[model samples]
Target: MAVIIKHNELEYAAKESAISEFALLTGKKQSGAEKHMKYDIRMLEAGRFSFPYHFHRNSEELFVILSGCAVLRTPTEFFEVHEGDVIFFEMGPDGAHQLYNHTAEPCRYLDLRTVSGLDVCEYPDSGKINILPEQEVYQTGDQVDYYQGEAQVRDKWPESVLEKSR
Candidate 1:
């Protein structure tokens, strides 16, 4: 039987699972996650984040604003979205994005994601993918130079300082 989610039910469900669902996201943390179909909608409060700054190479994200507002933060910029707003984030370089609830009141929204196989995500600031068991993860930054093969390096900083003195 097909289940039709009513307006009230959706609101209740979002609030009930919002916190737990957000915390359930794991695996490297950078690549983000897929919310279970049961909790397809998410409601967040001020200072709450939907996901870390990451981009899925495969899946597309869709959002329908239900109440309050949120700031959709992208790699290069951000957009302030409010109720009645409908938006879709595609997959690719231009599609990478994350959203944040910045209003005093909780912002409720519908998040719909299409499964696009197993995808690797990248964090712009961290420059690392929470690589799944199948995907390769890499570190990116100006401070660290890339190397191939079994590279060896000696840190100039004292290794002794990192250990706890007994």
Candidate 2:
């Protein structure tokens, strides 16, 4: 089936935080796309940010500047993007990025990203980890070893169950 949603019909949802703010319209969902890729249209107001500076372990993203301009901050450098510009971000640490609208005018862009069953996003500046879909966010500094709490596993089982296994 083909789904066609006119740009003029897009209804955006607004969100704001201390440093971030945007009006977003989920293109993928509106089109009934269930897998593989996700896209959204976003409008970022001047002096606002798109998202936290982070990189995905399993997903790649692309941004198309539809109108106006913004400053893109990455791990190594910053870029001034304008209308008609397309930016691709690869997966992992090298792809860490965040966009800020530095201009006085509002900026609109299309954010397209590959979808995965599970994704881990690392925020280097804030020492935080975010698990997508699940919406689980944790501080990296509080991480524990895999086996840190697995001691005395045999004691957890009843003596009768252990004897049968032996």
| Best by the lDDT measure | 2
Query: Against the hidden true structure, what lDDT does model 2 obtain?
Result: 0.84
lDDT of 2 by residue, 65-158 (tens): 9889999999999989999999999999999999888989978888889997899999998999999979799999999999997899998989
lDDT of 1 by residue, 36-92 (tens): 321255666677777667777767778788878988887579989999998887776
Q: What is the TM-score of each candidate against the true structure?
A: 0.61, 0.88
Which numbered prediction scores highest in TM-score against the true structure? 2
Q: TM-score of model 1 relative to the true fold?
A: 0.61
- Candidate 1 deviant stretches above 4 angstroms: 10-39, 132-166
